[model samples]
Target: MQRYPMTPAGHLALEEELKHLKTVERPRITQAIAEAREHGDLKENAEYHAAREQQGLSEARIRDIEAKLGGAQVIDVATLPKDGRVVFGVTVVIENIDTEEQQRYTIVGEDEADFKINKISINSPIARGLIGKSEGDEAKIQTPRGEVEYEIVEVIYGE
Candidate 1:
């Protein structure tokens, strides 16, 4: 099994979600299905159909989460090297060459990518461009909005 990188926090989050799904969602859906089955003719029972659909979806999600958690290689960001290179688990500050705006990004695993948190997936174009780059280096990334240029301002390990 190929192990993918994940932060410690990300691993914990997935574990919690998996626990909730298996304990709470699975039992609730099972109960719903049982109750629906008691309502008579199965052929025309909307409740039964809905409950079955929900059960299928929930089970699929549970399996997916389980697989991800199984293959996760959790890394603690604070333990990363203090080198100025932008790498996984490092927080990078980049200045847009054109707009002159600064933005901070942390390169993380696929499951931990959240735009709201400014965490980008390692496979993302921007993150790919930023990876292996040192402070004062420039990275050109192709975005949906076209090519954007950014100069690496700083790189912080762990914190």
Candidate 2:
């Protein structure tokens, strides 16, 4: 099985979601299905069909989360050496070589990436270019806007 590299928080988030799905969503869907079933005429029961579809989707998500959790290899950033090199679970501060703009990005697992929060996937083009690079190293990454060069300003081990 391919192991998924994730931060400790990412693993915990997935576990929390799975718990919510099992404890909250599953029971709610089951209750909805039961209530719909009581309405009779199963063939014409739209509520029953909707509830069943929702149940299927919820179950599928639950299985996906479980599989992801099983494959997860959680890495604690705090345990890593605070070397200047960028690696998985490190927050890298980069300065745009051309635009002179600075941005902070935390490299994380695919499921934990949220651009709005500056959490980028390890597989992302920018992260790929930044990985294994030390502070002050220049990385040229290909993006939708074209090739952009950035200078690594700092590599942070933890949040």
> Which sections of candidate 1 miss by over 4 Å?
none
Among these predictions, the greatest lDDT belongs to: 2
Q: At residue 50, what lDDT does model 2 achieve?
A: 99
The TM-score, computed over Cα atoms with residue i paired to residue i, of candidate 1 is: 0.95
Question: Global lDDT of each model?
Answer: 0.91, 0.95
C-alpha positional error of residue 26 in candidate 2 after TM-score superposition, expressed in Å: 0.4
lDDT (Cα, tens digit) per residue for candidate 2, span 26-75: 99999999999999998999999999999999999998988888888998
After TM-score superposition, the amount by which residue 146's alpha carbon in candidate 2 deviates from its true location, in angstroms, is 0.7
TM-scores for every predicted model: 0.95, 0.95
Backbone clashes in model 1: 0
Q: Where does model 2 exceed 4 Å of error?
A: none
